[model samples]
Target: MTLTEKTAYLKGLMEGLNTDDKVIAAIADILSDMAAEIAEIKDDVDELSEVVDVIDEDLGEVEKDIYEIDDDDDHCCCCDDDDDEDYDDYDDDEDEYEEIFDDEDLYEVTCPTCGDTICLNAAMIEDGSINCPNCNELLEFDLDDIEDEDESESEE
Candidate 1:
């Protein structure tokens, strides 16, 4: 039986006892009040559960829209490689990007503090120094030595 029904039955039993004990009557009244409060709390919880389910469904739809999720597709949007044509297009774009940077000399420098390799260009090297992005340590380049070597090489 439901808690409310059980409490009501107990209350009816207590009333039928016709007891002179004030304590028994008071306990019965407390039990009845507790049952009512519990029923109200259960109803609130049920309503909240329904609201949460609706929100969850809404969130799932939003995620599908944002991520371009397809019901039949198993792969994630970013990592999907099912289309060979699209993959070839991506490769062409990458090759174009490489061609753009081919004329410019790229230098790789390893940070002494963090051991992270950083790629730089001639202009950045001419600036003499840059902070290591990983550790924020000041790294100075000896441009004079590099210039002297280049000059010597040209002379040779």
Candidate 2:
């Protein structure tokens, strides 16, 4: 029925032939056919090996997407703020704004209250305040008025 089955059948028949020239010739023909079939199988195996290698490479990239995180916070915002530590976005306006140390690699933000140091991003700091998600203390303070004064009033 299949190539493998046919090859096996021909091999058995070739071994059991009697002492006749016709039987010998038939055996030779079947051996040649079997050799060609074996070659085709080897080629198919090589192709499958290449396909498996590509699938393995794709799986490695998928692992990175699953493990990567946006924030690398260890203890989180609800922790204590270091009074002596300065924020990443510090200004020289006041003692509260002064940086505790010079660490450029790490981000820093000052808690509006107690002048505590908070290490985080400006975007995460949110609304001019370092509201410590760790201590539940509003670390940063924001005084915002989105309404702008009319230009016509200034001209008058």
Candidate 3:
């Protein structure tokens, strides 16, 4: 039986005993008080359990809202697997740029911090540096390094 039913049974048994001993009556009174306290504690625990269930349901709704927000976003990397398609578009743009400008006359440098590919002329690589558009980090290219490599290759 449930704890409440068991406590009720004990109370009934104590009442039926009709004991004359004062000690027995005092003990019965203490038992009654303990049973009542236990019932109150049970009620409190039930209320707390209901509150926990409601909080858990609210958390689930928040998770659904977060998912919906992600679903509505088209360019979010976490929401879709079309990152390769984005890269393909970048490649197409690069091809079109190459058709308009001679690739040999341009130097391509990728920003180390932001991975932004920047096209620079040979003169710019020698004396100029660019700040990355995406991350605003300074990017410097050393054209002397290329000249050094070429000289070493010619000596060999």
Residue 50 in candidate 1 has what lDDT?
Answer: 100
The lDDT values for all models are 0.88, 0.61, 0.77
- TM-score for each of the candidates: 0.52, 0.31, 0.39
How does candidate 3 fare on TM-score? 0.39
Ranked by lDDT, top first: 1, 3, 2
lDDT of 3 by residue, 6-125 (tens): 666776786798866778667667776787788899999999999999999999889978865455556656755765674788888998877757655876788899888987776666
Model 3 global lDDT (CA atoms, 0 to 1): 0.77
TM-score of 2: 0.31
Count: clashes, candidate 3: 0
Prediction 1 TM-score vs. true: 0.52
RMSD of 2: 17.2
lDDT at residue 76 of model 2 (Cα atoms): 56
Candidate rank order under TM-score: 1, 3, 2
Q: List the pairs of residues colliding in candidate 1.
A: none
Superpose all Cα atoms of candidate 3 onto the true structure and report the RMSD in Å to 1 decimal.
10.0
Off by over 4 Å in 1: 76-81, 84-120, 124-156
